[model samples]
Target: MPPYFYKKRKRGAVSMNYSQAVNWIHSRLKFGIKPGLERMEWLMNQLGRPHTNILVVHIAGTNGKGSTLSFMRSILQEAGYSVGTFTSPYIETFNERISMNGIPVSDSEIAQLAAVMRPLVEKMEEELEESPTEFEVITAMAFYYFGSVNKPDVLLLETGLGGRLDSTNIAEPAVSVITNVGYDHMNILGDTISEIAAEKAGIIKKGIPVVTAAENREALTVIRQFAAKQQAPLYELGNHFSAAAKSRGEYGEIFDYAAPSLQLTSLMTNMKGRHQVKNAALAIAALEVLPLSLSEKEIREGIRQSSWSGRFEEIISTPKVIVDGAHNTEGINSLIDTVQRYYGDKIVHMIFSALKDKPYQEMISLLSEASDSITFTSFDFPRAETAENLFKAAKVQHKSFEEDWKKLLLQKMETMREDDVLIVTGSLYFISEVRNYCRKNFLEK
Candidate 1:
C-alpha cells in the first residue's frame, strides 16, 4: 500500500482537537530535504506574511542550535518580554515544535489550527504548481498561530536543515546565530568544512548582528568573510564573549559568562554538559545586540530557568536512565565528554541507533570508549538503521535482539543495579520513542 493510502482511512473523520489534527497532518506529510525556499515563501505569503510582525532570532548550525535557542528564550522571557520558539524534529509530540511564552502549544489550539490549515494545504496541493513540503506547511501554521493569538515580542526560529535554503529562513531576523560548523548532512550541504560553513552562514542577513560560537579556523574565516560582505556585526565566541562552568552537579551546572557589554556570575542552568555553557554564552552575546529592553538581572534569571529535554537528560532515579539525541560525531563527542565527567570510572550500558545517512561508524567508534555494553534498536522511521547493521558496525558484545523496543528496554532496566547507568541515545527519533515509553511506564505514577 502507498503512504497516502493511510490518509484515506481518516479522510472524513472530524478531529476532536488540535492534537489530533496535527497527527492527521503528519500522517500525510513526510520528512527529508525538500530543497528550495520558493514553496515556503509562497505558503507564508498565503498566511499574510506573519513573519513581519515579530522579531525573529534565526539560529542554524550542525549542533547546539536547540540548546542556544533554549537559553535565549529563557533570557528574553525573564526580561519580561513574551517569547515564542519554533524548533524541529520534536522528541515527543508535534506540538513541541511550537511554543507560546516558553510553553508548548495546547492540544485544542493545535487541532483548531490544523483544521483551518487542512483545507489550505489541500488547496495548495491542487492549485500550486507543486505542493509545499511537510516542514514548510508546518512553518506557515506556526507563524500564523503565533501571530493570530498572543503575538509574541520575539520568536527564536531554529532551521530544519541548512540555513541558506531552509524553509525557516524566510524571516527577516533581528539577530542571527550560528553555533559552530561540523561535518553533518554531507550529501546535501557539501562534503567539505568550508562548504558546510557557507551553508550555515547563509542565515547572516544584511545589516543584522550575528553571534557565532567558537569554530575551527577555516570555518571561522568563512563566516567572518560572509559577515564582512553582508555588513553584519560579527560577535565570535572567545573574542567578544566566553563562558565556563564553575561547578557541575546532578541537578544542574553553575557557570559564569562575559559578553561584550554584560557580565554575569555563577548562573544556574538545569542543562548538563560543558558545551551548554558555551551555548549560553552565545545566547548572551546575541541578546547584547538586541534593541529590546532588558537588564542583567533578567538575563541571569532566564539562564537559570531554561530547561531543554533529551540532551543528556537523566530520566529515572534508581538505575539512572539517560537519553541524549547525539546523532552526529560532534554531538556524540559532547555526550561522551559529559558521561566521562559526571560518571567517572563508572560502567555505562548504551542503547543506540541512528539514521542510515549519518556517520554511524565514526559515532560508534567514539561511543565505544565510554560504553560498557550496547543494546541496538531501531526507531519507527523509514531511514533508521537496523539493529543488526549497527551491531555489526560497532562489533560490541550485546544481548538478545528482542522484537519490541519497549520490552527490550524494560528487560535491560531489570538487569541494571542502582549504581549502573543506561544511556539511551543515537537519533532524536529513537530518543523520542524511548522517552514516550519511559514516561508512560516508568515515570508516570
Candidate 2:
C-alpha cells in the first residue's frame, strides 16, 4: 500500500482525491504571502530535508525567470541529463508546476503526494498557529517528489516570490540566477529597483556562482555587493556574457552568443522577441558557470527547442492571434517593443485583462502603442479588475469593454482582416483561461 493510504480526517482535515486535493491545496492561498523561510525550513526538516539531496539551479527575478528556466531545462535535457523543474502559476494546468524531464506530474501522483503529506502539514499548522502559504506547500511537495520518487540529475527551481524568504530558497543551489530585477509585486518586494534587486539577490547562496542579466546601475550595485559578501563568483550579463540579434522576424530569431569561455554565432531560437536572446544568454552563462561540461551543439539545439507558451505565442496564422503574459509595466513594455519590432506596420487588435493590484493602467498605456484598437475584458479570477474599470483606467481613444472574453474574441475575429492581427495579453491567469477557451472553441474545431 502507498504511504498515502489509511488517511482519515482529523480536526476537519479530510483526505482528498485529485480534484479535491487541488482545491484543498489552493484553499491555503488565503494564508497569503508570508515573506520568511522559517516555515519552509521547518517543513523541509519534517520532510527529511529532501532539498539538500538534489542539485539545484535556483532562478529569481521579476520577469524572464520562466523563459530562462525553459532554456536551461531544454539545454540540460539535450545533454542527456534527467531534469526536474518547478515553475509557478501553471500556465495551463496544476500538474505543470512540478515536471520530470519536461513531463508534468500526473493528477493521481499529485493526489497521492498530497494525501501522504496532509498529516504532517496539519501538524505544522497546529504548532505554528497558522497554515503555510499555498506556494510554500507546493514547494514542499516539489522538493519531496524530486528528491525521492523522481530524482533527477538536476532541479531547476523558479522562485514564487522574492528570493530571500521564498520557499524555494531553502534549497542550496549549485548556481544562483537573477534574471534582471524590476518592479512587479511592489507591495511585497519594496518600491525601488535596488530594493527589489536586494530581494532577488537573497537567493545568492554562499560560495555559489551567481549569474544575472540585471542592467540597471543601482540594481547591479546591490547584486554585486551581495555576491561579494557571500564570496560568490558573479557573472554579469553585458560584461561576462552577451547576445546580439543576427536576424529576427515572424518565424523566429537568430542571435550570436559571446562569452568568456565560449562563443557561438547565429545560435537559433524559436522563442519570439529580442529580449529572449538576452534570456537565452543568461541561461547559457548559467550553464557555463556550472561544474558540468556541455557541447556547443547541445546548447544550440536546446535553445532552438526552447519555447515558453504565452510569451508572444502565436495561436493562429491568418489575421494572426498572439497571446502573451505581460501583466506588469516591465513585461508590457517588453511586449510592446517586441510587437513593434516584428509587426510595427500591421494594425493590431488587442484583448486585455488584469488583476486588480497590478499597475494595469500603465500596462494599458504601454500596450496602446502596439494596438490600434483595444478591448478590456475580465476573467473569473477573484482579484480580476472589471472590464469597465480597466477601460476607464486606460482611457484610450479606440477602446471598448466586454465582460466575456470568448464573446469578445469571437466578435473581433469576425472583423479582423488578413493584414491585421489580434493580440491577447495581460495577466498570466487571464491569458491561461483565454488560451484554453481558444483551444476548445477556435483551434480544436
Report the C-alpha displacement of residue 114, candidate 1, in angstroms: 2.9
Q: Which candidate ranks first by lDDT, i.e. highest?
A: 2
lDDT for model 2 comes to: 0.88
| Alpha-carbon shift of residue 109 in model 1 (angstroms) | 2.2
Q: Cα miss at 348, model 1 (Å)? A: 1.2
Cα RMSD, each candidate: 5.2, 2.4
Q: Measured by TM-score, how close is model 1 to the native structure?
A: 0.92
TM-score of each: 0.92, 0.96
Alpha-carbon shift of residue 402 in model 2 (angstroms): 1.0
Local accuracy by lDDT, each model: 0.82, 0.88
Candidate 2, residues 65-135, lDDT tens digits: the string is 99999999999999999889999889889999999988998888888678756777888878887678889
lDDT of model number 1: 0.82
Residue range 1-445, candidate 1, lDDT tens digits: 1223223325433444655676666765754558788877776676677777788899999999999999989888887888899998887787889987767877776766676566666767788857666787778777777765557888889998889999888889999999989999999999999999999999899999999994689899999999999999999998888887899966678888886577888888888889988888888888888888778788888888887888998888777899999989999999998998888677788888889999997888888888887777786788898887877787555433443578778888899877898998889988988888788877431
* Most TM-score-accurate candidate: 2
User: After TM-score superposition, what is the CA distance of residue 313 in candidate 1 from its true location, in Å?
Assistant: 0.7
